[model samples]
Target: MQSSSSLFPVALISAERRGDLSEDVYRLKPGNSPDGTVELAVTRLGLAEVAESRGVPVILLHGSFSNRRFWYSPKGLGLGAYLARQGFDVWIPEMRGHGLSRRNRDYAKNRVADYARYDLPAIAAFVREQSGQIPHWIGHSLGGTTLAAALGGQYLGAPAVASVALFGCQVSRTYWPLKIPPVEWGGRFILKRFAQLSGARLKRGPEDEPIGLALESMRWHGLFGRFGDGERDWWKGLAEVDVPLLAVSAAGDRQDPDWACRKLLEQVGSEHRQYLCLGRRQGFSGDFGHVEMLVSKAAQVEVWPLVERWLKDPLTPVTGAQPEVLAVG
Candidate 1:
């Protein structure tokens, strides 16, 4: 599907390699929901030229408010395109309430559980069924939380995940008071009323979706450091996940503190986990805020390479097993 919005061409070395990247929309059958039969729409970026040569599949999930288009910015911050160049099948799925997937026509009907129970599992199953192999999973912010919840046994069974990478996941009790009040109460109330009136459906936008909705979603989950309260028991769910895990944090991110992320990594039962924090002093890529890490120009230089190295490593248990503990500095 062609986007009516302005196209900012991504940076690429050669035109021929650039031509190998293709984008398309896909519909998924999410089985059943009391609200209705749920169908999810996803935007896929398939690298036909490089994927066959590399022999790995990578899937990306975006945070709330933003859609898959966020990955294809003009600065070459597009995660899908960069991963495609690395010779991996890159798929970016539009969550239930956002983008073309808003087919329910009722925005209020959109639930976070749709991501935990439906979207992530469906994408994993799709990759396994189609490619005959389990793909590495990476998610940021809300997307990361959804993946963590899924891996923690909320949806699909464990062991189905090969390796998991999370960026900016807050998994501690202390990090709970950062929610912005008006956004926490007002956003949901508005969306609930909006969904009731619109019947859970909203049209695709020529302009960006309202910033209030994004702020509300962030606040509702305490991602902005206001109330620090979360809609789900994500920390409890995360403790149950057993897989090769990598947790990343940004020193400057208020939404997810460096300590919260470290504490989460320390608590995981899996011995096969690594933790890294990036900033200017660390000689990392960009001095980014919460959203910029995945979409910043320097992400290609600093962030993606670390992720690529971890993904390329064999999925074996780390030699020295450590009990799950939470540590922050």
Candidate 2:
């Protein structure tokens, strides 16, 4: 079914009820991208009882091998749904060939550079045009890395972004072997034979990632390599980002340690920024894992309220929102 929207060119796929919340799924074809090849599925969640105009927009970017389901589940649960019930107009975008976004002829070659330089800006523009306000962005894992790249490269900025929150995102983790040319090239050479890395095969997640992503990662971690594409130095560009920012890390997350996550936050030039360490040692109930940091019941009880508080007021003293034990240290 098709619906009319003065906002953007989107096909209304479904508008169903998830208890007291209204779930509207739209297929957005933003041909403005460089190649005009990707179609994105954006899921909008809002409170059924309230006017959508009353809700501010917040975009959730899911990590690699994931979809809108990362931020929102089918049973009407997840942070996206939680925010919607709290009167936030939540938008979860599935990146190219991920989740509901259909693959392109070159889907196997999609990279973060394309995502930051093109896809994100388009999503931000459409949301801002529709909402009549700058939207806040929240991204977990690889999604957060993409957000950093966009901000660092100047693809997404103040005119479109109200704030940004990165959950368990870090690109500075050092791998000594990848720094060696032979090691890096050899790995990429072997991976070139495959179109995508199987998440199920690796036991990492549910979705598969293109081989291009792996090759890109190897390049960034190569000797003398940095966080940006060959053109821009995204790591250095972080020093220019002035928006309110929050970087969260979980101690139990071995893949992206809290220390590495903190390094990513420290590079940001934002005067209003915070580094939240999620661990029992930090006074949380447990050492949250990468995925558990957001999706677990423990997060719902303790972490979600803190996130809600930050969104409501970016300048509020985070000290008051965190566990009192942190003050002692």
Candidate 3:
């Protein structure tokens, strides 16, 4: 096995020699579409180093209002770099309307459903075409929801997702506290008026910065305790996912409460499932917030080990003793 830091030098040197932007660098590039083109930005890491080691490929999906850079920041967590050092190919995608993925000059419409139906599926296809294998799927928040939707038969010719790991996603309508009131009671008129005034547009981040986008998105979705209930049917698709699931939750995450994650496991309908609660024993004083789990400094030492152990375990029936858990909080 090679050290994580060893994976980058060669690639960096090669890129410099060839005048090519290294994978560890971030860039906003144009994406092809039947109608025109879209500017899709992404942060590539552990390309030459991990690929040289013949590691398993992993694709990371960012939450709403976030871009790929979320995984590269010091506070953004070290999962991508750590996994790359662990010999896994990692690709972080910026979904449309967020980060670097923006619509063509002529078409600026941003639809949430379109992200599920188009952006995610295209990313999956791109991964398969590039790696010739189905990469492991990991997501958080809206990203997790979108991935679940893709696996639930929402997309055409969906790739075979090997395994799935989700953080902060819910299914039941009960998990969502918002509901439409009776139209006869004038609720519909109020909603219509509100929509008109607000416009059916995707919320923009406070700035073009990745973390800013993340914060803004969380705020818009009421994940920070601002909005009412989320869409109940959004999680119904999880029932169709048959892959092994590693569902992690933050005890302090007020956005997607721990109860929602627990319910997701109980009703996910997957035979192979594991649930992890972070900061439970500490009275929720840990740094494992909704987004911090993937971006915080402590995440590498605290969270990645569990993920690695699960991924490295054999897919076959149990044959050995279970691994012991390490208390991080």
Candidate No. with top TM-score: 2
Candidate 3 local Cα displacement, residue 108, angstroms: 6.5
Write one digit per residue (lDDT tens) for candidate 1, span 1-329: 43222221111212223365755556665554454545566555557554444457777777655667666643334777777667666667777656656555434444455567656776677666555677888888767766766765457445357777788876453423435566456555655443232212443322233333444344435644422224445446656667778777887888788888777677666657777676765555445677767767677666666666667783532211212222221
Each prediction's TM-score against the native? 0.72, 0.95, 0.67
Clashing pairs in 2: none
lDDT of each: 0.60, 0.86, 0.54
Listed per candidate, the RMSD to the true structure in angstroms reads: 8.6, 2.4, 9.0
Better of 1 and 3 by lDDT: 1
Candidate 2 Cα errors over 4 Å, as ranges: 1-8, 320-329
lDDT of 3 at 36: 44
121-142 per-residue lDDT for model 2 (tens digits): 8789878876788999999999
Q: How many clashes in each structure?
A: 23, 0, 5
Sort order, TM-score high to low = 2, 1, 3
